[model samples]
Target: MTATLDQPTAVATGVVVRPWRAVLLRVEGQWTWYRRHWTASLLSSGLQPVLFLAAMGIGFGSQVRPGPLTGGMPYLAYVAPTILVSGLITIAVAEAGLPVLSGFKWKQDYWAVASSPVTPGQLFTAELVWITLRLVLGSVLYLVVTTLVGGWTSAGALLVAPIAILTGAACATPVMAFAATTKGDGHAFAAVNRFVVMPMTLFAGTFFPVDRLPVVVRPLAWISPLWHGNELARGVALGGLRLWPAVGHLAVLVGLLVFGLVLGRRCFRRRLVV
Candidate 1:
């Protein structure tokens, strides 16, 4: 007998029995979509860090003298770790915003996923895991470019990958939760970039130290996750981090991740399981 037009052509994998497996399957779906359009993504994602490094760390850095502002290090090396962290934040913002809303409002793949036995929390976890994976891979590439550009100074620079990933995750989770809650068009995403991401990138020590900011507004930088991540990256790469400060920076990232995850799971359920 021939199957009807409504019948699924592929063989069934059956219900995903384990929670971990369900989450992995959802991540696999994300990977499949990425694999198809990876070339276009590479043009933007791959070249961005390289271009940023060349511009800010090389060209602009040449004009900057090594001084107290730069901790006696060349501006290139001084800014590279922070630039790496900032790049991850850029990518995280791009991924966590419109694409997440699209999964719900436009493409509606999320609704299809919701029909499955997978819980909304697992779906949220998979998205976070995928974003983390992107940060991990991007960090490796950015570090390589940093080395090639002479921006790498210490052997400890290798540690910047985890620091950058944590920083990116801290930013991404909350943005994803916000995206899931937004009901309108791309305007909301644009606003996120304009208001949230842009301000943080400019003021969160990506190019210079936050201490340069006026004392009255310095607390704003202190509360920024990017600033904390940048500090950790710069400290490890340049070798000046005190033990207590490192712990404090870590606590902030972990706290943000947990808070975002709680909100994200709730938002996903509200949107998808409706």
Candidate 2:
């Protein structure tokens, strides 16, 4: 007996199959598209970060004397890891916001994919996975540039890649949830970049310590995922991160990621299922 078109091929062969296989297949499709247009993405995720490091961390850092503001280290060493994570967060926000909106609205590809055997939840997971892969590639490239430029202060900086991905996801998943709820020509995405992403990047202790901010504005940095990520990445790179504090920062990032994942999954289901 042969399996019908609707029947599972693995089941016919007396093998069990996992639902996540569909999610992986969807991620593969995303990868195929990314492979073709990766050069465009490389500009933002890779080259842009390198230029920022060279101009801000190296060139400008040379004129500033190391002090309490820089933790007694060269300004470049003090700022490199934070900038790396910030770049990842920027890329993640862009990928998760407008592109997600396009997938549902302009492209309508989500609906077409949902018409198949894949579930809405699987589609969400696939999107998250694809974003993770992109972040990884970008982080690796950024780290290599940092090393060549002598911006990486410690060997432990190698761990920044995974931490950067976590940081990006913490931001990306929430933005994706917002995108799933939007029904417009993506004007809201511009507002998100302006009002949300830009503020977070500027005030999240990426270029300077959050402590330098006015007392009234300090809370904003404390609540920002980029702040936590910057603290962790800088601590690891500079060899100052304590174990308990590291755990606390990791917990916050993980919490945000979980909350966003749940919210995004629900939003995707509501939008795609009906």
Candidate 3:
């Protein structure tokens, strides 16, 4: 009897497949779910930011005259980019935090997904991609509204979307990692929102220059990813950021995002694979 050994079909055919294809399939599944509820998502991600701009940037800003802090521009112009970053961060935190916990605990969806060919790292990447899709959609809407409200000053303002997404990733990845490790219902997420996110939004130069803050507390804003985002967004929108400073801000955001991704991947593997 002559037994023939089977050849590796993929190598023989010269067809190499990427591992990230599985991650994209998972992202497609998330897109399907998002499509069904896109209206509600739009309300939260799109309309909410517009309302905030209307109320704070326009209505409240009307009373504040141009000043040194505002660089002789309307307060609306000064605060618009900051608000955009704020909205991105809020949405990012929500998408990454509780839903992540639900995936592991309430719904056990992570377990279900892991049972397939998809690895834990791919699942984490898919989650980040889903969150990024939401941020991009929301940010586009915000930019349209900001333009209508006279918030776009420089053409460079267009860079806000990608910068905001980067900022969101900086915040979301670490939060997702924490959520992956949670063993209970997501009570801790609420605390994080109330304590950490709230303070960051208030103090991260969203409403004013961080330098204007007390010297003792200025370091707090210095360490906030939101502050870095706000600085870049406002600088680009106002046509003031130098090339080297812009590169530095981008590097900081990228660094945080990378660190968080590493931590999130490890946590996801620990929670799902073991």
Candidate 4:
């Protein structure tokens, strides 16, 4: 017997579940794109962090004494985890930017996928997965440099790369999902950077402690995934974190991702529907 176009749909409704097809599409696209131009990819993800680490950690760290991050830990050690988080932040934010806009407007992949067997939820899943991969890749390079350059003080923090990526995606996915809702022109992401991310990057205990910020603003830092991630990552790097704090940080990351996924799926549905 021959199958018609609706046969796949009928079969799926009856008994079939595929969780990550959209995710595979994203990862596969990254693999293909990177294969064609590996150098630029590395430069953007790897080299960029290395330079930032050199200038920020090593260069400036010399003047500062072993401070709060170390409780005796060097300033460089104190700051490495934040840089690691920064790399992931960059990648996650990028996933929300041009590519998302292109998918909606230029490439119309969001529309194209809808005509296929994919659901908006699946697309959301795929995009989040892809963003996670990109963030992770960027993070690992930064971590390795932290180790090689002595910015990372202990072996424990070696595990922080995956943690950082998860946290970054927790933050970025919802932001991207929000971006997906734009009809045509969207500056929401730029606004996020200028108002949201940039503030988090500076005051969310990345360079200085969140305690240093004003009391009113300090409460807001609690809402930043980067701050939570940076704290966990730096503490782990310094061998300074308790188990409960680590779990708490991870929990926040999970919550953010869930929130983003739910909202992003809704946004995708609204934006793609003609």
Q: lDDT values of the candidates?
A: 0.87, 0.87, 0.87, 0.76
- The weakest ten consecutive residues by lDDT in model 1 span 43-52
- Candidate 3: what lDDT? 0.87
Off by over 4 Å in 3: 1-17
C-alpha TM-scores of all predictions: 0.92, 0.91, 0.91, 0.87
Tens-digit lDDT string for candidate 2 (1-274) = 3456668555334443356898898988988887898777777556666778888899988998899898898999998998888888888988898899999988889999887778888899889988888888888888888888888777889888889889998899999999999988889888988988789888989888888899999998898899899989999888879999899999999999999999999999999987
Which stretches of candidate 1 lie above 4 Å from their native place? Answer: 1-16
Model 4: CA > 4 A from native: 1-17, 41-43, 68-70
Extract clashing residue pairs from model 4.
70-73
Query: Per-residue lDDT of 138-234 in model 4, one digit per residue for the tens?
Result: 7777777777887766787877787788877887777777778766576666787788777888878888788878888888988888888888887
Best by TM-score: 1
**C-alpha RMSD values across all candidates:** 3.2, 4.2, 5.0, 4.4
Relative to the unseen true structure, what is the C-alpha lDDT of residue 204 in candidate 1, on a scale of 0 to 100? 85
Backbone clash pairs for candidate 2 read: none
Over the stretch 1-274, how does candidate 3's per-residue lDDT look in tens digits? 2344455444345443356897788889988887898876676566766788899899999999998989998999999998989888988999899899989988788899887777888899889988888888889989998998788878988988888888987889999999998887889999999988889988899888888889999998888899889989988889778889888888889998899899999999998887
User: In model 3, how large is the Cα lDDT of residue 161?
Assistant: 80
The better-scoring model by TM-score among 1 and 4 is: 1
